[model samples]
Target chain A: MSTRRIHAWPVRLTHWLNAFGMFCMISSGWGIYNASPLFAFHFPTWSTLGGWLGGSIAWHLAVMWLLVINALAYLLYGALSRHFARDLLPLSVSAVRRDLFAALRLKLQHRLGHYNAVQRLSYWLVLALGVLVVLSGLAIWKPVQLHGLASLFGGFDIARYVHFFAMAGIAAFIVLHLTLVLLVPSTLPPMITGGRRETSHE
Target chain B: MSERKKAPPKLEPAQQTQVVNLQRRLLLRSGLSLGALAMLGGCNLQDGDQVDKLLWSMSRWNDRVQAWLFSGQRLAQTYTATQITDPFPFNAFYAEYNVPEIDLDGYRLEVSGLVERKQPWTLQALRQLPQRSDITRLICIEGWSAIGQWGGVPLRTFLERIGADTTAKYVGFKCADRYYSYLDMPTALHPQTLLALDFGQVALPPDYGYPLRVRVPTKLGFKNPKHIVELFVSNQNPGGYWEDQGYNGFSGI
Candidate 1:
C-alpha cells in the first residue's frame, strides 16, 4: 500500500468553503422563502439558517459573495492548471455507461488515486450547475438591471423558478454525493488532508 | 496549434438572416434549460452559530453591489391591465387589519430639507398636478410578485415642482403609519416613480396607503413608503425602519 497527494490545497479549500457557504445560503434561503412560500409546507424555523425573513436576506446576500469568489478562484485555477482536462475530461461514452451500470449494481471499483467515469461526469456537471445557479440567481435578484439575463430565462418569473429548482437540484446532488462518500470512506480523508492511500500497481 | 480554417462563402441576406435567427433561438433555449439544470445540485449538512456573522457580512457586501448596479434611467417591467394580479396581496410588518387610519380632513404632506419650498401641501393640491398611471410589477423580497395599476403624479414632477435639490443624495420619507423609508436621488428621479394617490382609479384604501404613498416600481415593496406625511432631501443617509433592522436600504430588484 502507498499514499499519494490527490486533492490539491485549492481544491480542498474551495470544496469545504463552498460547502459552508452553501449551507448558510440554503438555510437562510428557506427562511426567506417561508415569508411567501411557494410550496405547501414551510421549513421549520430551527432547521432554517436565518432567524427571520429580513435576517435571511442579509445572510443570503452576504454569503453569495463568498460562493462567487470561491467558485471563480476554483475555475481559474482549474483552467490554468489544466486540471479539467487531466482529471475530468476525455470521458469515454462506453466507460461512462459501464460505470453507471456498475454503480447501480453496487459492483463499482473504488480507486483511491483516480476518479471513475461517473464521478468525473458528475463533478463537471455540478461545476456547470454552480455557475448556472449564480447567473439565474443574479437574474432574479436584479431583474431590471439584468433585464437581458432575465429575458434570456423567458422572464423574471421563470428566472425565480429556475433559481428555486436549481437549488433543489443541487440539494439532491448533495444527497447522492454524501451517500457515495460514505460508501467509499477513504475519499473523505483525501479531501481534507490532500493525500490518498493506494496499493502500488507494480 | 492547428491551421486556421478558410472563411466560408457569404449567403444571401435573407438566408443569412434566417440562419442567424435560428441560431439565436437555439442558443436561448439551450442556455435557459442548461442554466436551470446545472444549479440543481449541492447541500450543506452542518449547523453552526458563526454562519450568521459570515452571512450578515456578505449581505452588506451584496448591498453595495446592488447599489452599484442600479440605474435610474432603467424601468421595471410593466404589464397590461389584463395581466395585473387580481387583488394584489397586502404585505407589511403588521397585519392587514392593523392598517393605520388617518383623518383625511387634516392630512398635510410636509416638505423639508434642501428644497426651495418647505410648505406642507394638501391632498387637494397634490391631485391638481399632472397625473400619470402605470401598471408595473411589485416584486417582494419574500419571493412573490404582483402587478398593480397605480395613478399619481410622477415623483420627478413632484420633486421638481417642490424645487427639491435634485443633486441631493437622498429623499427621505416619514409615513403616517410610523413606517419610514428613503430613496437614492437617482431613484427618486426615475421617470416612472410615482407619489401615488390611487390604487385602481379611486383613492387608495387605507390598507393601500390611503391619502398618499410613494409607489416606487423600481424598488421592493417595503422601499415604497406608504401614507407618507413628510419628505426631506438630504445628503445624510436617512436609514429606513427595515433598513435599520438589517434589510438593505437600496432594496432594488
Candidate 2:
C-alpha cells in the first residue's frame, strides 16, 4: 500500500460540513413539515430532529446560514481549482450507458483516483439538486420579497414541492453514494486521509 | 473442479475466532463513535443549553436579515375578487369554537405608547376612516397559504390618524382571544397593511376575527393578530406568544 493525495483539503472540508448541514436541515425540515403537512402521511417521529415545530424551525433557520455559506465555498473552490471540470464534467450519454451496464454486471473497474462515467453524472446531478433545493427554499421563505424567485417555480405553493423533490433527489444520491463507498471499501480511506492505495491486487 | 480449487482456502477455527473478535471490536468502536458524535453535535441538549442559545441567536440574526431585506415599496401581489380562496381556512392557536366574541358596542381599541392620542377608538371611528380593500395571499408559518379579500383602514393611515410615533421600532398587538403578536416598524407602515374589518363584502365573521384584525400580507399569518384589542408602539420588542416559545419573531414571507 502507498499513500498519496486523492481528495483535496477543500473538498474534504466542504464535504463533511455539507454533510452535517444537510443532516440538520433535512431532519429539522421534516419536523417543520409535520406541522401542517401538504401530503397525507407524516414523517415518523424517530426520523425527525427537533422535538417540536418551533424547535425545528429554530434549528432549520440556524443551519441555513451554514449550508448556504458552505455551498458558496464549494462552488468557488470547484470553479477556481477546475475541480468540477476535471472530475465531473465531459460526461456523455454513451459512457454513462456503458458504465451502467458494466456496473449491473459487476464488471465495472474501480480506479483509485478517478470517477467513472456514472459517478461523474451522479455527482453533477446531486450538485444541481443542491442548488435547486436552496433556491426553492429561499423562494418559499420570502415569497413576497423574492417574488421573482417564487414565480420561477410557478409560485410559493409549488416551490415547496420543488424543495421537497430536490431534497428527495439529494437523499437518493446520498444513498447511492454510500452504497458505492461500501462496495468499494478502499475508496473510503482516500476521502478521510487523502489517499491510501492498496496495490496488492485489482 | 477449477471453481472448487478457487474456493479451497478456508479460515481455520483460530482464525475464525480472531475474525469474530475483530467484528465485535469494530461494532463496539462504531457504537462509541456514534455516541460521541451525537454528544458533540449537541442534539440531545435541553432548551437553554449552549446549543439552544446558539440557535436562538441565529434565529434573531435571521430576523435582522429579514428586516434588512424588507422594502416598504415592494407590494405583495394582489388578486381579483374571483381569485380569493373560497371558504378560507380558519386558523388560530385555539379551535374555531374558542374564537372570541366581543360586544361591538362596548368594544374600544386601546392605543398607547408614543402615540399623541391616548384615546380609545370605537368601531364606528375606524369604519369612518378612509377605507381600502385588497385581495392578497395570507401565508402561514405552517406552510399553507390562502388568498382572501380584506377590507379596512390602511394601518399607516390609522397610525398617522392616531398620532402614533411612526418612528417607533416595534408595534405590538394584544388580541381579544389572548393571543398576541407584534410587527417591525417597516411592516407596520407598509401600504398593504390593513386593520382589516371586513372579509369579502360583509363584516368579518367572529371566526375570522370579528370586528377587527391585522392583515399583513408581507408577514407570515401569525404576525397578523386577530380580534385586536390593544395597539401599542414602542422601541422595545414585547415579544409574542409563539415567539416567546421559539418561533422566529420576524417571520416574513
Candidate 3:
C-alpha cells in the first residue's frame, strides 16, 4: 500500500467552500420559500438558516457570491488541468450500467488513480445541475433584465420551478454522496487531507 | 470489463449539429447578457479583503444593466381587483408597530433638485392630480409576492408637472421614517410608477406607506420607498438605504 495525493488542495478547498455555501443557501432558500410557500408544508424554522425573510435574503445573497466564485474557480482549475477530460470524460453507457449495478450490489471497487464510472457520472451530473441552478437563479433574480434567460426557461414562474427542482436535485445528490462516503469510510479522509493510502491490485 | 471494452456510440451528423447549436445558443445568450456585469471589473476573485468591494461594484454594475433594460412604456402586469391579496403583508425594516404616524395637517411633499419648481405640495394638492389606479403585484426581494390595488397620480405626470428634469439620471426619495431610496430616471418615469395615495381603493394605510409612497411595480418592494416626504431629481447618484448596504439600486425584476 502506498499513500498518494488523490485530490489537489484547490479541489479540497473548493469542495468544502462549496459545501458550506450550498448548505447556507439551501437552508436560507427554504426560509425565503416559507414567505410565499408554493407547497402546503412549511420547512421547520429550527432547521432553516435565517430567522426571517430579510435575514434569509441577506444570507442567500451573501452565500450566492461565495458559491459562484468557488464553483467557478473549481471549474477553471478542472478545465486548465485537463482533469475533466482525463478523468471524468468518456462516460460510456456500458461503464455506467456496470458501475450502477456494482453500486447497487455493494460491490463497487475503489481505485486510487481515477474515479469509478458511477463516481465520474454522478460528479458530472451534479456539476451540470449546479450550472443550471445558477442560471435559473439569475433568471429569477433579475427576471426583467434577464428576460431572455427567463424566457428560455419558459417564464419567470417556470424558472422558479427550475431553480427549486435543481436545488432539490443537488440536495438529493448530497444525501447519496454522504451515504457513499460513510459506507466507504476510507474515501472521506482523502477529500480532507488530499491523499489516500491504497493497496496495489496487482 | 467486457462491456467496458466496447466503444461509445456515435451521434448522427444532424443530431451532433443540433447539440452544438443548442450549446452555442446557451453560451451566446449568457455571454451577451451576463457579460456586461462579468466583464466590468475583470478583477481576480481571489483578491483578499477586496471581495466586498468587488461585490458592491458588481451590484452597481447590475443596477446599470437593469436600468438599461428598463423601458418606460412596458407596464407591470395588472391583475383584477379580485386578485388582490386580502391582507397584503406589512413589511418594513422595522416592526409593523413602529410604522411612522405623520401629522396630516402639516404633511407636505418637498420637491427639489433639477426641477424648475421647488414648491412643497401638500397632501391635498397631490390628491388633486388626476388619480389613476392599477392592480399590480409588489414583489419583495425576499421571494414573496402579493397583488394590491393602488391609486395615485402617475409619477411621470407629477414629475412633468413639477418641471422635474426628466433628463436627470436619477429620481431620489426621502421618507419620514428615515427610509430613503431612489430609482433610475427611466423607472421613475415608468407609466406604472405612481405616487400612491390610496391602497385597495381607500386612503393609504399607515402600515403601507401612509400619506404617500412610491409604488413602482416594475421594481422590487424595497425600491418602492414608502412614507415619502421629499423627492429630488439628480444627475448624481443618491445612495439608497438598502442600496448603500449592498442591495442593488436598480432592483427591477
Task: Please provide TM-scores, in order, for all candidate models, with all chains considered together.
Answer: 0.85, 0.89, 0.69
Ranking by DockQ: 2, 1, 3
User: For every candidate, what share of the true interface contacts is present?
Assistant: 0.66, 0.63, 0.24
- Give interface RMSD (Å), model 3: 11.0
RMSD of candidate 1 to the truth, in angstroms, is 17.7
Q: After the best TM-score superposition of candidate 2, give how far the Cα of residue B121 lies from its true spot, in angstroms.
A: 0.4
Candidate ranking (lDDT, best to worst): 2, 1, 3
Query: Model 1: what is its DockQ?
Result: 0.24
Which scores greater on TM-score, model 1 or model 2?
2
Which candidate leads the pack in DockQ? 2
Q: What is the TM-score of chain A alone in each candidate?
A: 0.93, 0.94, 0.94
Q: In candidate 2, how many Å is residue B179 off?
A: 1.0
Candidate 3 lDDT, tens digit per residue, B1-253? 1333556459898897566454433332332223222322354433322433444555656666666777778666677888899888999989988999899899999999999999999989999998889998787876667889989999999999999899889999999998889988888888888999999968999998999999988899999899999999999998777765545667788
* Candidate 2 per-residue C-alpha lDDT over B1-253 given as tens digits, one digit per residue, 9 for 90 to 100: 1222344347998897566455433332333233224535565543234565576788889999999999999999999888899889999989888888899999999999989998999999999999989999999888899999999999999999989898889999999987888999899999999999999999999989988999999999899989999999999997887787678899998
Clashes of each: 9, 0, 0
Cα lDDT, all candidates: 0.80, 0.85, 0.79
